[model samples]
Target: MKGRQIILDQINGREAAALMVDGQLDDLLVEGDAPRPGTIYRAVADRPVKGQGGMFLKTPDGNVFLRQVKGLAPGDVMLVQVTGYAEPGKAIPVTQKVLFKSRYVIVTPDAPGINVSRSIHEEDERDRILEVAHEVSREEGVGLILRSACEGADRDEIAEDIANMLDLAEQVLADAEGAAEKLLDGDGPHLAAWRDWSEPAEVVTEAGSFDTHGVLDALEDAQGSRVSLESGVSLFVEPTRALVAVDVNTGGDTSPAAGTKANFAAARALPRALRVRGLGGQVVLDLAPMPKKDRRGFESALRSAFKRDPIDTTLVGWTPLGHFELQRKKARQELREVLK
Candidate 1:
């Protein structure tokens, strides 16, 4: 997290996007007028569609794809959470098995159980949270999922999180009964960054309200079009219609060891670059050719690099043309669209 920073953008005195983070542009922002991913909408189940295998739930904005049809009939109204970040002309998924997320825990109604974050690798810490769950879990049809933020949290704090979420669950249920096409509690990009990434990232902005330095100052050309890493290596980034392509060069090297080292460095840097550029769908990385033995676990390393990204990414294996492949969910509008 050495070069970690969240640089904010301002358009006519309003927040827009992150201009730079570790020498990359942030594509992780939702459009200003769009509905956020965490927004809860009260939807009525419409007539089931035959081919799609899901019913269209009607909200004020448009239809939402609801996967569950069992025990559900036409005109059945209920609460649903927006699982997919919505886009223009695109209907995202929503579910009755809603997950209420907080800084410490995720409370799910309908699916009752207690679990911990998989990212919490330590068994001791996981068990301790589970023990707290046993104490806080009073209802049968509800479940608790301890977040990674709960790692070293005090017992009282965990209990308070549980109590607060339970109250929220009750509120969501009570409000759903008398509501029609209403948005309840929600979260947006700026608030989400404040809530989840405050500790790991330094929030930097060029706005008159805030002070700026570090990553913001180091950036010479915005969007990191010309990136020179501290290790004296450079990356050539090209955004094309089909895919975003990156070329890793150690200032012109042909040796296999040099190729491997550069590829590793590129893998480490690619996530931040991708997040900054908001380049998704498919990505191709060109690295210098190395021995087959040196390629071991490189794909995993690339996937791990993207683990911090808001959207999930997958390694799609290497191509026959010697390029590495990765695909991440396009969570927001493309960086180019926002720049306009």
Candidate 2:
């Protein structure tokens, strides 16, 4: 493999060099010119200072710099990773835009469906929401759901959703300033249910405990079979997000399936397993096989079954080495937390 190197240093600690192989981090070697920029790092150091669209820039002093990237604010926190560039020059930085979007509600008119909505882009509306949230709390008591999840939501619900988030925003500020330890964050059980429903796993919360039923019932009412709770976990499989991966262990305790028919049953259920587990991305299902040709047939059947799920799913068929692969989209982060 081919590689390159970049040096990074800590102000008080020793220096180290990052090794890159094929554009990937391969190793870190000690002893190099990893001098710390020996400078203060500030995200929001300066305000626009009396202009609507003034720009910002980072000026380097000697080999040291105070980075000013377009679209970056003075107070923003940055996670900097050094990447190798072809051109020569020590530590030339190129800015990349990263949008951190939070979930929001979308509202629509004409649908009798409860709580219909479209997701909101943080860039598009967070300021307005924050401002109004303060106002709403001062006058009318309410909360808001920032609405990124409502990308395709209905019309009538949008206003109400905004109102809800605004209400929450004001409370967040008040609790912080008042130093109220008991102040809870503004998330509702309904939103909490959506968080569970957005996961790519078959969510299993303890059966009769924690109002899991209410969560499941509300999700079902709003999203239909896209959400379900059984065996102490609730399962939500949606197509709007990225794919998740699931690993089913035959648990050294249960003996493996005995025959071809049984093996076929397991293979046949791969799609459902993917759906139930919300295993998206490039799924490589390595189950006990039936036979050579049977594997292909089972994959075909599984592919067909995945169509019934509301989420978008595609089976890449079996690998030459025997493993089922699938590609799918799922909600963000929920699946990772659930699986963990």
Candidate 3:
């Protein structure tokens, strides 16, 4: 209960995985209706949008939108991968760049290189991982990226992972000469948990693990709009059609520095809150009434917090109305939508 735990369970017959850290829900993954990111499709190109610089492609599931379409012509066949979840009634977002990602390595086609994770700072460790990568026989022009999980891992296990990924990539790429069809389905929640959550933790696979470990209760709290911070401070995170709106409040605290305190607390708690709730896209924060001089401090705190967050987020700076704006990638399905 005091350490990290990975709880795998089923909710409404859909696979779900929860990351509990020190008795609190840190992250969550729930299977949704859309195709998961990294699913590769051999698609037939459809009509290109006249002004958008993107084209629609016909996949087995449905039509998907691929951006940066420069040379793609109608009826041309190409391989594409799902990039992320699409909005309601929108085409699934996809990219021509497909990657075979595993726990220890990511096989990149069309990009040739062998690179170790920068986090493995020791020269010896880097060289060792590089040596292992070189030993694997892969197709020319295919790249290998050693993930951070390779650090301190068993050499044999790392090599096996790299080899397996490389094999899978080769297989998938070879099958790309066909008509519109799915080449590979993305990893499900259970496999994704094992693949992405590489940190040391106790694994729970029991049927009632979510309820037994209090993950259900934590998820209920995350679904709400209010997140309690330190002391009596709190923040309301409400997602609307256009953007997510966050309102930080000082609550009963009437001290002179209450606004600044609440702002900083909200800054620290915001990333985790959004992550667990699976909220993304444009995020606008309406912080407590702090002075202009404190804006820099709030921005610093927010930037630092998001730096630790795994999702890609751009701090777009403050609005003219004293609100902070952020553009976060829609990496996962929204919790409210997923549960419904």
Q: What TM-score would you give candidate 3 relative to the actual structure?
A: 0.97
Top lDDT prediction, candidate number: 3
The C-alpha stretches of model 3 lying farther than 4 A from their native spots are none
TM-score list, all predictions:
0.76, 0.30, 0.97
Off by over 4 Å in 1: 1-12, 15-31, 45-56, 66-78, 86-89, 93-97, 118-128, 175-180, 198-211, 214-227, 230-232, 236-243, 308-310
RMSD in angstroms, all models?
4.3, 19.0, 1.1
Q: Give one digit per residue, the lDDT tens place, for model 3 in 188-297.
A: 88999889898899999999889999998998999899999888999999999889999999999998899999999999999999999998889999989988999999
Q: Which ten residues in a row have the lowest lDDT in candidate 2?
A: 35-44
Candidate with the greatest TM-score versus the true structure: 3
Task: Give one digit per residue, the lDDT tens place, for model 1 in 1-340.
Answer: 2455665555444454353445444444534455566678888888787877788888886788887577878888888887654444557767676778777888888888888989889888898899988987888888888888888878898889888888888787767854356566466556565545534565665564223433333322435555565456777777776777888887666565777777778788777666655566677888766777878757666767777666788888888987888776756555545545
- Indicate whether candidate 1 or candidate 3 has the larger TM-score: 3
Q: Is candidate 1 or candidate 2 better by TM-score?
A: 1
Question: What is the RMSD of candidate 1?
Answer: 4.3
Worst 10 residues of 3 by lDDT: 131-140
Q: Kindly indicate the candidate among 2 and 3 with the higher lDDT.
A: 3
